[model samples]
Target: MLHIVNKSPQERPSLDACLRIAESGSILLIEDAVYAAVKGSASAGKLAEAAKKHRIYVLLPDVEARAIADRLVDGVTGIDYGGFVDLVADHRACQSWL
Candidate 1:
């Protein structure tokens, strides 16, 4: 499955929802959601834990308006806008976590 996330921990319900998902194979960070990896993001540790535990692929656009794309965490993969589309084409299903 694929997940498109556009919310950070500053938002509550959605953050909780994302943690509860059973299968989010590839997670795409878009818009302001990219801040989840920025320094001091409250959810960074939790998000990292989720990725490791579930083996979920964390994908973020190579260029983000909110955070330094090149500084993405170890488990996160940098992708382009077109790559997001390709991921959906390659997956059987997708869910927008935002």
Candidate 2:
């Protein structure tokens, strides 16, 4: 399963809710949710912990657009649009947290 979150953790509980419920799978942070992938953000620790059980990814373009590409959390992989497509194709199912 793939869990996709596009909201900022600072502004929404969608990321927290998804993390709590998703046991094991992949997580792709897109749009403002890329903020959660930053090195020292409030959700950084939680995201790091989640990375143990989930394959954590942030959309590279989104991170770059936000100008925080250099500060991404250590374990979170950065992906491009093509990588995003491949993730959706690789997973059997996907849930986008609103």
Best-fitting candidate, scored by TM-score: 2
Model 1: residues >4 Å from true position, as ranges? 54-63
Write down the lDDT of every candidate, Cα atoms only: 0.65, 0.95
The residue-by-residue lDDT of candidate 1 on 1-98, one tens digit each, is: 77777766576456557668656466776666666665446766777887775433434543455447656655666677677788889888878875
Cα distance off (Å), candidate 2, residue 84: 0.5
Q: Which window of 10 residues has the lowest lDDT sum in candidate 2?
A: 69-78
Over 1-98, each residue of candidate 2 has an lDDT whose tens digit, in order, gives 99999999999999999999997999999999999998888999999999999999999989989999989989988899999999999999999999
- Candidate achieving the largest lDDT: 2
TM-score of 1: 0.77
lDDT score at residue 98, model 2, on the 0-100 scale: 90
Error of 2 at 23 (Å): 2.1
Clashing pairs in 1: none
